[model samples]
Target: MDRTQYLQQFVDETGWYNSIVLGLILPEWIWRPLPFPLQSWLRNYIGGSLLYLVSGFLWCFYIYYLKRNAYIPKDSIPSYRAMKLQIIVAMKAMPWYSALPTLSEYMVESGWSKCFSTISEVGWPMYMVYLLTYLVLCEFGIYWMHRELHDIKPLYKHLHATHHIYNKQNTLSPFAGLAFHPLDGILQAIPHVICLFVIPTHFMTHVILLFCEAIWTANIHDCIHGKVWPVMGAGYHTIHHTTYRHNYGHYTIWMDWLFGTLRDPEDNYKKGE
Candidate 1:
C-alpha cells in the first residue's frame, strides 16, 4: 500500500491539542490580558510553580507524614530544615526553568521544530514511533548531561553541587526534586527541548511530557525501590545521591547500563546486610 493510503486508516479528529492548550496552558481569562511572550512566560511560570509545589507537598506529606512510620524510619526522614531549603532553592530556580518552555513554545510557533498540533497529522503508527523516539533521545541526552555535570569540575562545583547537598536519605525528599542551581536544572531539562528539533512530536504530548518531569523527579527522590526493571526508580536515584558516580539516567536505567554505571539496589542491600 502507498504511504498516504496506509496513514489514512489512522486519521481521527481528536481536538486534543487545542483543548489542552486552551484549558491548561493558556487559560483565557487569566492570560488574555497579557501580550504574546509575556503571557506565555507568565503562564508557564505559574503552571510550573504550581505543579512543583502541589505535587511536591502532597507526595512529601503522604510519605513523610501520613505514612511516616510505615514508609520510612523516623530517623531517616528528611529534616524540616532540609526540606525547607529544598523548597526555597526550587522556587528560586522555577522562573528560569519556566523560561525554557517559553523559548520552546516560541521555537515551535516559529516553525523551527517538527511538532505537529495533533496525532492525526502524523498518523497513529507514526505518532507512536515518534513519541518513542523522542523519549529515547531524551534519555540519552539527559544521561550524558547528568554525567558530565559531575565529570566537569567547574560545572559540578558551581552548579550541580547545589543538588548534591542533599546526599543522604535523611536529607532527601520529594522537595529535593527541582532543588538545583537554576542553570543546572535547565541544562538537564534541555534534552526534552532538543528532542523536539530532532523528531516529529505531537505538540501537546511534548508539553505534557515536559511537565511530567516534575512528577517523575519527585517519584525518583522518594527512596522507594519500586522494583520496576529498566525504570530509574527512587531506589536507583537514592544511590545516585549518595554515590555520585552511578545511575545518572533519567526515566530509565538503560543509559546507565549501557554506559556501565548501573548499580542495582539489590546489590547495595546485599552489601549492607
Candidate 2:
C-alpha cells in the first residue's frame, strides 16, 4: 500500500480504539462517578499531571533503581536528588500550565468532541481524516517550538535551559522529562491548544492524546534505545539531549530529517549494545 493508504488505515484503527477506550470505557467506568469538577476538564488536566508523575516515577525507578544504566555514557552533573526536585516542581506547575490550553477550546467552538456516540455515528474515513490532519498540524507546531527552544539563546537560557540539565548523560531520568521550566512547557504544549481551537477534535481523542503524550515524554527521558521506524523514540530523544544539536522534532523525525537536524542513533553509544 501507498503511504497515504497506510496512514488512513492506521488512523482508522486508532480512532476506533480511542472511541472505545476514551469515550465509552472511561466515561462509564472512570469519569462518570467522579465528584463534580473532578468529572470535567479539571479532571483531565489534573489527572494528566498525576499521570506525568506516575509514568515518570515508573521509568525513573526502572533506570535508577532497577537497571542502573543510561542509553548514553553516564556523566556526572545533575544528581538524582536534583532530578527528583525538578520533577516535583514541574508536576506541581503542569496542571496550571496545561489548564490554559484545555480551557481555551470553548473560545473556538462547541460540539468538537469525538465521544463514543459521535464516533459511532461518524464514518471512520471522516474520523480518520480529522485525526490525521489534527496530529500533523500539532506535530508541525511542536517541531518549530522545540527547534526554537534550542536555536534562540535568550529563550534557551530563560525558559528551555532547565530541561537541558538532563543533557548530561545518566543525569536524565523519567522525571527529567517534565523537568521543564513552566514557560518552556507551555510553549511546547501550545500546539495542542492551538489544535483544539483550529481542528474539529473530540474531547476523548484530545484527552487520550494528552495522556499518551505524557507517557511518551517519560519514555524518551528513560533512554531505552528503542526505535519505532519513522517515529522518533527514546533513542532519538537521547541523541538530542546528549549531542545538544540534533533530533529537535517530537513524535516523528521527518521534521528533523527535513531540516537537517536528524542524527543516526548508531552513532551514539548505547549500554550493552
Candidate 3:
C-alpha cells in the first residue's frame, strides 16, 4: 500500500489508540469535566466547533512568521490569481475540522464526563509532566505530519504543492500551507483526541495550549514579526523555508534532527548528490 493507504490500515487495526483514549480509559482531568449538557452543547452546536475551525485556519499566521516571504512569488513566482486557487482550496476544506468535536462527543455519548469540576486535586509535578508531554506530543506530531507531506508524492502534488506556489515567500503563507487535501486536517486532530482519551491533562492546560497555539500562529502569519519572534528567534524555521528540504519541525527544530530530515542549507546537499 502507498503511504496514505498504509496509514489508513495502521489506524484501522491499531486505531484503538485513539479509541482507547476516548472510549474506555478516560483521562479524568481532561475528559471527565464535560457534563452531558455542556458536552452536548459544545459538540452539537456551540463554540467548540468554531474554536476548532479558527485554530486550523489560524495556523497560517505561524507559517508566515517563520519565513516572511515564504508564500509570495519572487521575481520567479506565480500570479495573484493562481495564489487564490490555493486559498480557495484551503477555505473550501475548513468545514472538515468539525470532526474534532467528536472526541468530546465520545465522552458525552458514553455518559462518562462530569463537566466543570475543578482539577485542584492533582499534584504539581504531574501537571508539569502533562504540560511537557502535551507539548512534546503535539510538536512531534506536527513534525512527522509535515515530513510525511513532503515525502509522499500524491499528497505533495495535490495538497502541499499548492503552498509551494510561492517562489517568493511572505506573511499570509501559513494559510496557504494549511489548505489541506481533506484527509490532512482530519488526521491532525486524531492525535490530540487520542491524547485526551489516554493522557491525563488538565482541562485548563488543554484549553490554554490550544489558545496559545492560536495566538502564536496568528502572529506567525503576520509579516511584521517574521524574523523577530515573540520570545525566541525563528531562524531554524526560516532556514527550512529557504532550503525547502530541511528543517521541517514546527514549534521546535530538535525533532527534525532526531528524525534525520534536518538539512543545513550552507552545505549544498546536492553538491555531491
Candidate 4:
C-alpha cells in the first residue's frame, strides 16, 4: 500500500487513538475471563467508585497539607464550623449519589456497545469512536443541565445551593466537591445517563469517562489554579463558583464562550481592583 493508505489503515485498525491508550492500560488479557456485562458493571461500580475515592482523598491532602499555608483570600474562607457542617452533610448523602450512576449504567446497555468478542475483533477503532462521540454528548448535556440548575430559582435554592455554600469568594475545598443535595447531584448527572440510552457507548468508554469526571468535579471545586486551554481546569471552574453567575460549562469553556457566559479570570482579578 502507498504511504497515505498505510497511515489511514493504521489509524482505522486500532479503533482510534483512545482504544490504543485503553489497550495499554488494560489489555485484552485482563478482560478475557469476565463477561462484558460483568466488566461493564464492575467498571462503573468498583473501579469507578475507587477512582472517585482516591481522587477525592488526594485533593483533600493537597488542600489540608500542601496548600494549607498558601495564600487564600480571607473573604473566601468559610467559618471552621461551617466547613465542618458542610462536610458532614455532604458525606451523609454522597454514597447514595455515587451509586445512582452504576444503576443507570446497568440499565442503559444496548447493542450499540461492543460485546467482548466484538471488541477483540474490531480492536482500537471502536473505542476511539466511542470516546469522541460520547465526550461531545456528555459535555453538551452536562453544560446545559448545569446552567439550567442555576437559572431555576427553587432548584438553585433547595438543591444546588447546598453546593454553592462552598462558593464563597475564594474558600472552596476538596471535600466540598461532593457536597451536594442528593437531588441536585442526580440532576447534574442526568446528562450522563441520557447519553447512554441515545448513543452507542462502549462499556469501558463509559467507565473511563465517569472516572475522569469524578476527578474533574473535585479538581474544579478545589480552586487550585491552573488552566488547560479549551479544557475547563480549576481556574475556570473556580470563577464559576466564586461569581455564581458565569462560567457554567463543564469539561471545557467553549460552550461558556459560545453562550456569552464565559468570564475571564482576568476579570475576576480586576474585580479586586
Candidate 5:
C-alpha cells in the first residue's frame, strides 16, 4: 500500500478526528469490574451507556448548529470562572450524596440521588410507569421549585439568583447549572433523578431515559422567546426565565394549566415547531 493508504487505515482504526459535541462521555467513565471475572456486568451496563452517549452526541451538534444560527443566543452566557465554580460545586457534592442514608436523606441531600433512588425502588412494571408519572410530577415540581426560589426571600437571595444571571436562553448551555450553588444543581437535576429510583426497568428504559433528558432539555433552551403552542419547544421555559413565576414544566404542558402556572393555554403546541 502507498503511504496515503497506510495512513488512512491507521486513522480508521483509531477513530481519529471523531468528534461529538456536548456528547455524554459517561459510558467511557463507567467503573469496570476487576480481577477479570465480573467485568461482564459492567460491559452490559456500559453498552447501554454508550448508546446514550451516541444519541447525546448528535443532540449536541443539533444544539451547536442552532446556537450558531442565533436561533439560540450564545452571548451574555456564563464566564469560564463561573462555569468552573459550578462544576467544582457539583463534584464536591456527588460523593456526599451517594453515601447518604434513606430516601428522605436523598431528598434533603442531592436532587440527583434522591430521584434516581425513587425510580430504582419502584421496581419493573411500575418503573415503566415512571416516565408518565415523572412527566406529571416535574411540571409542578420544577415550576414551584423555580418560582419559590425567586419569590421566597431567603431562597431568592440564596439559591435561585445565580441561574437568573442569563440574559438570553437561545444557546444550548450544558453548563446552565455550571456555577450553580451545589444546592441549586440538585434542585434542578434531582427532581428527575429522584424519579429514576422511584421506578424500575431493564437497560433499554435506562437508555431511553438518558436520551429523553438531553434532547428535551436542549430544545427547552433552543427557542428565542418562550413562544406558546406549536412552538412549545422553547417558549414555556423562555417565558419562565423572561417573566418568572409562570410556565414550569419541562416535558408536558398539562401541569402548568392544572396548577394555574400555565402561561397560555389556548396556544396550540406543535411539535418540531
Candidate 6:
C-alpha cells in the first residue's frame, strides 16, 4: 500500500473524533445556558484562569514544597511575596489573554480561518502535515514576536518588563510563568491565531495547543533543568530571564540557534561563579 492508503488505514483504525468530542463535553455543557459572544469570552476567561491557577499551584506544591530539595536550593526558592506578586500579575492579565482565543474562535466560526472540524476533511496525511506546519509557523512567529519585545525599548519597558522582574532564581517560580503584562501575554499568543489563517488547522487541536501554553509556561518558569535537547526548558529560560539577551525562542531553541541568540544553561552557571 502507498502512503495515502496507509494513512487512510490508520485513520480508519483510530477513533480520533471520539477524543475530540470527549474534550469538548465539559466546555459545551458550561456554554449551554450562556449567550453566544458573551459565552465565548466568559468561558475562555474562566477556563484559562482556572487552568492557570490549578496548574501553577500543583507545580509549585510539587516542586517547591514536596520535592524542594531535589529541584530547588533552599535559598533559591522563590519567596511567598514574590509568588503572590506573580499570581496577582497573572490574574490581572488572564481576562485579556482570554480574548484572543474568543476572537479566534469567532473567526473560525465565521469561516475566516482555515480551521477544519475533522481530520478526515483533509485526510490523515494532510492532517498530520498541516498540524506540523501550524506548530512551525507558531514557533517562528513567537520567536520573532518575543525577540522584538526585548529589542524594542518601548515594548520591553511598557509590556515585557513586567515578566523580567523575576530575573533571578529566587524570584522565579511556576506562578511567574504568566506574570506578564496583559498586552504582552496577548501579543506572544497572537501567533497561534495567525497560524489559523495561514493554513488548515484542526479546531480542537488548535484549542488544545493554545491551552498547552499555560502548562508549558509554568514548566519553563520552575527554574529546574529538565535537560531535554532542543526543548526550551526551564534551564534555557532561566538564562533568558537573567541575561535578557538570549534564548527568546518559544517552544524550542531552534529559532534561537538559527537567529544567533541561543545560550545554554551552563553558560549562566559559569558567569555566576
On TM-score, the leading prediction is: 1
lDDT: worst 10-residue window of model 6 = 10-19
**Candidate number that wins on TM-score, 1 or 2:** 1
Model 4, runs deviating above 4 Å:
1-54, 70-83, 109-118, 121-123
Candidate 2 or 4, higher lDDT?
2
Per-prediction backbone clash count: 0, 3, 19, 7, 28, 0
Off by over 4 Å in 5: 1-67, 70-131, 169-174, 177-179, 192-215, 224-232, 264-273
**Ordering by lDDT:** 1, 6, 2, 4, 3, 5
lDDT of 2 at 141: 95
lDDT of 2 by residue, 34-56 (tens): 54333344545556666777777
lDDT score at residue 268, model 6, on the 0-100 scale: 65
Q: What's the residue-level lDDT of 120 in candidate 5?
A: 48
- Candidate 2 is scored at a TM of 0.74
Clashing pairs in 4: 14-124, 14-125, 15-124, 15-125, 15-126, 16-125, 76-170
- Candidate 1: count the clashes: 0
Task: Report the C-alpha lDDT of model 1 over 1-273, residue by residue, as the tens digit.
Answer: 664443332222112322344457566786556566666677678778888999988988898888876877888898889999999999999989989987887777666787776677779999999999999999999999999999999999999999999988899899899999999999999999999889998877887898999999988998877999879999999999999999999999999999999999999989992
Reference-based TM-score of each model: 0.89, 0.74, 0.57, 0.72, 0.51, 0.88
Model 4 C-alpha lDDT per residue in residues 1-273, reported as the tens digit of each score: 554553343224323332343444577677546654444444444444456566766766666557664734545444556656656766676565656654554453322322222345446787677667777887888888888889999888888888887765345765566678978877777777677766656555564566566677877776656756887877777778877888888888888888899987767778871
Which wins on TM-score, candidate 1 or candidate 5?
A: 1
Off by over 4 Å in 2: 1-42, 68-79, 108-117, 269-273
Clashes of 2: 3
lDDT of each: 0.85, 0.68, 0.49, 0.64, 0.46, 0.84
- Runs of candidate 3 with Cα error greater than 4 angstroms are 1-87, 102-117, 170-174, 211-214, 221-235, 238-242, 263-273
lDDT of 6 at 240: 92
